[model samples]
Target: MLTRRRFLLALVGQTILGWAKNLFAQTGVFLTEQEAPEAVFPEATAFERQVIKATPELREKMQALMGKFKPSIWEDAYTTFLAKKGGEFLGYAVIVEEIGKHRPITFVVGIQPDHKVHDVAIMVFREPYGGQVKERIFLKQYRGKSVTESFLPFQSVRSVAGATLSIHALARGIKKAAALVQAVYQEGKEGGW
Candidate 1:
């Protein structure tokens, strides 16, 4: 002889228990739907801003790598990178560390002065697993490409002996990493920064 109120209570109780069990049993990773709110960053006088959404997978992968190396990047040393409230930010760059076939590779890429390879620096293209990337002929071939080349026909790019695969991956990673920088640079240039 359950009252109507009692029946409703029991239903709620069961639902709560079921939800708890499901929550506790889930072993897979949890993905955040939206990124947390960002802290207030400094503003510029005339420079426009370009912001890109950071995918959860990309964020996680970066975090995992950062945790493993606990490395200190240049930005980390400076503490802040916000431009002054004037048209001063003509270019910006991001530091990305990628796990290549051999070892971790770090590089700097931003909008090029002439638009091809844009101001890309070899930085630390360290590899731990292979030696082919250390070849001179392979390294010299990357000097002339313009950012406008688009790197579409990757096959046209020269390949290193045993380092072909790693070089390709590293090159692609550098391009992807430069995307945000390019956006910001365009904005800054448009805004007269």
Candidate 2:
């Protein structure tokens, strides 16, 4: 026979275990390499990974071009996946992680070869709220934005009603990612940097 106290304790323990399971299950890939290509370039048949190392010279160039230091989420090196169809370049997909209100949001920014943004997708939104940033309507605003453009929340980019922090974080991240692509791929091709 189980006492009422024992039953209550058991229920609490089960609830804790359930939350623990959810936390552990979320540890896998947020923006997978396989999915980014498909999302950014659905018609593409092949993709290539372009790795850019964050050397001091490269960092200085990026800072100068962006007018600020690189976002902290970026590492010493990062990858930009280029999508192609039969050798015809489609665009590039770059994943950038930014700190949301209380958690990190991992997103993929697709940039065309012309330096304009193609699309934006939230691969993983860890916060309890602010998942609204993933909506198509919100993400569409990023299309065609470039490193030369400014993404001001509530001005150029519409801010989510309750997810202002997330909106700002994503807008900043997108700008940084676009600048990185421009500095490495576009400028390199043009000036042979």
Please report the candidate that would top TM-score against the real structure.
2
What lDDT does model 2 reach? 0.75
Measured over all alpha carbons after superposition, the RMSD of each candidate to the real structure, in angstroms, is: 18.8, 4.4
- After superposing candidate 2, which stretches have Cα over 4 Å from the reference? 1-31, 68-70, 188-193
How high is the lDDT of residue 102 in model 1? 45
TM-score of every model versus the real structure: 0.42, 0.76
For each candidate in the order shown, give its overall lDDT on alpha carbons. Answer: 0.42, 0.75
